[model samples]
Target: MSDEVVENDLIHCIYCNAGTVRFSEADMVSLLEKAREANSALGVTGMLLYEEGSFFQVLEGPAESVDALYEKIFRDKRHRRITKIIRESIEARNFSEWTMGYAGVTRQDLKEIEGLNDFFYTKKCFTELDPGRAKKLLEAFKDGNWRASLR
Candidate 1:
């Protein structure tokens, strides 16, 4: 028998999208370009969903790196009132293949993405968003996106 300890290197974080100026579709696309470049360099992977004027994003990666990235993102002027829905160590990455996945919200997606509708019609500041909801959304996004990528 051997005595060895393995470290947990994974983390998942979800945050609310708040700020005065809402990015247009083109603006968000440009933002995603920058994010993909930066995330690839930092070994980060995640998904960003934008709809109506709100955003729901899940970023996962090395704990330290993900924490750093989230700090920068939280301070970003384009967003505010960030509420962390989840933060825990994990065995694997849900979005291992994506540097930064982008999902521009459509009518059909409204019912699934947790904080979208509240942010859309009720002006919720991600107050009621929970970790379970966030996890489910991220997993579904990851699975569907990966499946589609394979085709």
Candidate 2:
């Protein structure tokens, strides 16, 4: 394949970190807007999970666009301590239609990582999380495993 096609067709998802000023209703709207704007401008797609006072976001798109967006995100003061979780060129987009899908995770959703050191602060752990394991953990949260984590 030609290099142009190779570059444009490559799919990748990268996780990122940011801090929240306040988890208010207005903040939620602004975040959704920011994601949409970023995705539209960069032709990116991905999911965002916000919890506690931190931000955990994923950006998926053509390899080049994703990388560029990541660089921009790193420099933005609205978010800090930027780290890359993973960057693999895949064959398909996991979040195809989402310009910037957003989700707000509560304290309940963070039970798994609560006592596991600073897992959230360390991007490497997120990168190492296989999709299945990540999904299982998330499912546990959704299934009301919040209290169970303390046991």
Candidate 3:
């Protein structure tokens, strides 16, 4: 690949975190609006899923932009116990159509994801999830295998 091609290569980061406080529907709407605006400006694309009081997000963009955004998320007071699950270069964005796609997950929606039985039964927070399982959840969302309400 040319230097320019390599320089423009995309990278993706997947992470999960606990909410400091349970977010209301209004709060989620506001958060998604702001995220979409900011991610659009940064040329980032991703999906965000919230269930109970936990969050799972997949962010893809230029490496610097993704890293910077992840740092900002890491320091955000709204989240706690943040755990990064994946970070690697990608050939292209998996969520290029959305600046920030969002879904509010329910227990029923959790049951639809194949490998998340543990979460369904134990109510484990996303931050406590296994990395491989986290990736599967992301793929499920990407593939429209979820029935969660979207935003």
Winner by TM-score? 3
lDDT of each: 0.70, 0.59, 0.83
lDDT of 3 by residue, 42-88 (tens): 99999888878889899999999999999999999898899998999
Worst 10 residues of 1 by lDDT: 142-151
lDDT agreement of model 1 with the native = 0.70
The TM-score values for the models, in the order shown, are 0.77, 0.64, 0.88
For model 3, the stretches where C-alpha displacement exceeds 4 angstroms are: 1-7, 147-149
Residue 124 of model 2, lDDT score: 38
Model 3 TM-score, all chains together: 0.88
Give one digit per residue, the lDDT tens place, for model 2 in 95-129.
55677666665544454444433443454333344
RMSD per candidate (Å) reads: 4.9, 7.9, 3.4
Q: C-alpha displacement of 68 in model 2, angstroms?
A: 0.9
- Per-residue lDDT of candidate 1, residues 79-134 (tens digit): 76777778888777776777877766654555545544553355443345677666
Report the Cα lDDT for residue 109, model 1. Answer: 54
Highest lDDT: give the candidate number.
3
For each of the candidates, give the backbone clash count.
Answer: 1, 0, 0
